[model samples]
Target chain A: MKTRVIVTLKSGVLDPQGKAVHHALTGLGFDGVNDVRIGKIVELDLADGTSEAQIDEMCRKLLANTVIENYRIEQA
Target chain B: MKSAVIVFPGSNCDRDLAVAFRDVTGKDAAMVWHGESTLPDGIDVIGIPGGFSYGDYLRSGAMAARSPVMRAVAEAAARGVAVIGVCNGFQVLTEAGMLPGALMRNATLNFVCRDVDLTVANSQTMFTSQYADGQSIRIPVAHHDGNFSADEATLDRLEGEGRVAFRYAGNVNGAARNIAGIVNDAGNVLGLMPHPERMTSDAHGGTDGRRIFEGLFSALA
Candidate 1:
């Protein structure tokens, strides 16, 4: 089985890279761009019978920093 | 005071940190390799120097944080040893779960390298005792992932408890509340983006960084 972990910075946390991208978009004459936030997508290939709790532990322990980012796991 | 400077494969600042430890503590610091799971006995201070540890693979400091030696470092920290991590070292500390928050890429997506002003937010920390409260000092920072972020409640608690040790005096990295360094809940660990070891001598055009190690030695002595 394969799993995907999506990690994103928490709201209210300043995303400078996102802000710079937003600025560049506006500079290029693209309007209506309210905001931009950056994140990470991590995919894992696990053996059969990998439990959801184990994947959740992976995200909490290493894939994402719980202090500043939130992560969700999805089966593919 | 006996001390140790953790050395990873890509840690270029280990010697400099070792020098700082010797200069301040009057004792040569042990250059502990990353593969060793044990630090020298009775070590009082541990310096995690900056560099592109493991070439910033996966994430900055991610690989280095999980290295075998970090287990020993974590053990020492839990025993109330003073630990100061600088720049990439800060990232490692966070990844190792020694400090809170993750250091992401700079908001500008550029490597920042220069002397920037920083405010001493909490002078009571073992590392910041040489600085006065609210004092502004210049220190050099060289990193692409110095932008600090944390959840709002955690940030509030860090602020309320006076755990924040330093704040950028200007727009350096777009850090939250302009935080430059912070102390852990037990106050024995500090993780900062600025490089105090790089500025500890007059040959480096500044001595502002000297007080930090000096203060640490004095307090720990």
Candidate 2:
């Protein structure tokens, strides 16, 4: 099985990199962009019978920093 | 006093931290690698130096925080042992959950590298004992993700408890309330983005950073 984890900076945490990209996009003549934020996607291929709990623990333990970011696990 | 400096693979300032330990204490600081599960005996101070640990992979200090040696560092920190994390080390400590808050990318989105004025917030802690209350000192900070962020309640609790150690005199990074360094609730663990070890000697442009090392030993010894 393959799993995808989406890690994003929690709301209210300042995302400087995201803001910079937003600025660049506006400069490039793109409008109507209200805000911008950045996150990461981590893909993992696990063996059979890997539980969602285990993946959640992985996200909590290492994949994402809970202080500033949140992670969602997606399995396919 | 005995000391140990943790050395991760990408830790470039490990030697500088070790040298600072030796310069201050007149004894060699053991360079404990990340793979080691246990530290040397009778370690009074543990220094986690700056640099891109684990190449800042997954997140700054994330992988290094979960390494074998950090487990020992955390155990020692829990036992009242003094632990100081500088620059990248600060990130590691926060990621390890030994300290509150996290260092984010600088608000300017640029790496800040220079000497800046810092005001000692808490002169009573062992980490800041060498300085007077609200004294201003200059130290060098070189980092990209030095901006510190935390929730409102945690920030209030940190201030109410007088855990904020050093605050920047100016807005070098977009740190909350200009906080430059902070001590854990127990007051033994300190995480700051500035490199005190780098400014420990006069030849390093000033000896303002020397007092931090001196302060730690005077309290412990």
Candidate 3:
């Protein structure tokens, strides 16, 4: 089974990189860009019978820092 | 005082930290590899020096935090051993859940490297005993991800309890409340983004950092 994890900075957390990108887009004449938030996608190939609890543990322990970011796991 | 410095694969400041330990305590600090599962016996203090550990892969200090040696460091900390984490080491401590908050990229999105003025916020702890409360000192901080962030409640608790050890006299890194360093609840673990080991000697253009080591030695003694 393959899993996709999307990690994003929590709301109210400052995303400087995202802001810089947003600035560049505006400078390039893009219009109506409401907001930009940068995040990462991590794809994992797991063996059969991997439990959801185990995947959640992985996110909590290493994949995402709960203090500053949130992560969503998706099965594909 | 006996001490040990944890050396990760990419740690660049291990020697500087060991030198600081030797100079202040009159004893050579053991350089413990990150792969080791246990630290040497009788270590009163543990130093986690700065560097791009694991090349800052995944996230700053993420891989190194889960390394084998960190387990030992955590255990020692639980036993009330003094632990100091500097720069990347501070990131590792936060990742290891030894300290509160996460150090994100600098607000300005630039790698800041300079000697900045810091105020000793709380001198009552073992780590800051040599400095008077509100004393201004200069220390060098070199890092890209040194902006400290925690939820408002945790920040309030830290301030309320006087656990904040040092605060930037100027807004150097956009850390919450301009915190330069902080101590854990037990007051034995300190995590700071600045490199005190680099400022320990006058030859380094300042000896302001030496007082931290001296304070630790006297406290341990």
Estimate TM-scores for all models.
0.92, 0.99, 0.99
Rank by DockQ, highest first. 3, 2, 1
Model 3 has a DockQ score of 0.90
By summed lDDT, the worst window of 10 consecutive residues in model 1 chain A runs over A60-69
Q: Write the per-residue lDDT of candidate 2 for residues B37-123, one digit (tens) a residue.
A: 999999999999999999999888999999999999999999999999999999999999999999999999999999999999999
Which CAPRI category fits model 2? high
Q: What fraction of the true Cα-Cα contacts (under 8 Å, chains A to B) does candidate 1 also have?
A: 0.67
Can you tell me which runs of candidate 1 are displaced by over 4 Å? A22-35
- In the range B1-221, model 3's lDDT, one tens digit per residue, is 78999999999999999999999988899999999999999999999999999999889999999999999999999999999999999999999999999999999999999999999999999999999999999999999999999999999999999999999999988899999899999999999999999999879999999999999989999
**lDDT against true structure, model 2:** 0.95
Top lDDT hit: 3
Clashing pairs in 1: none
The order by descending lDDT is 3, 2, 1
Question: Which ranges in model 2 have alpha carbons more than 4 Å from their true place?
Answer: none
DockQ of 2: 0.89
Q: Which one wins on DockQ?
A: 3
Worst 10 residues of 3 chain B by lDDT: B193-202
Candidate 3's C-alpha runs over 4 A off are none
What does candidate 2's lDDT look like per residue over A1-76, in tens digits? 9999999999999999999999999999999999999999999999989999999999999999999999999987
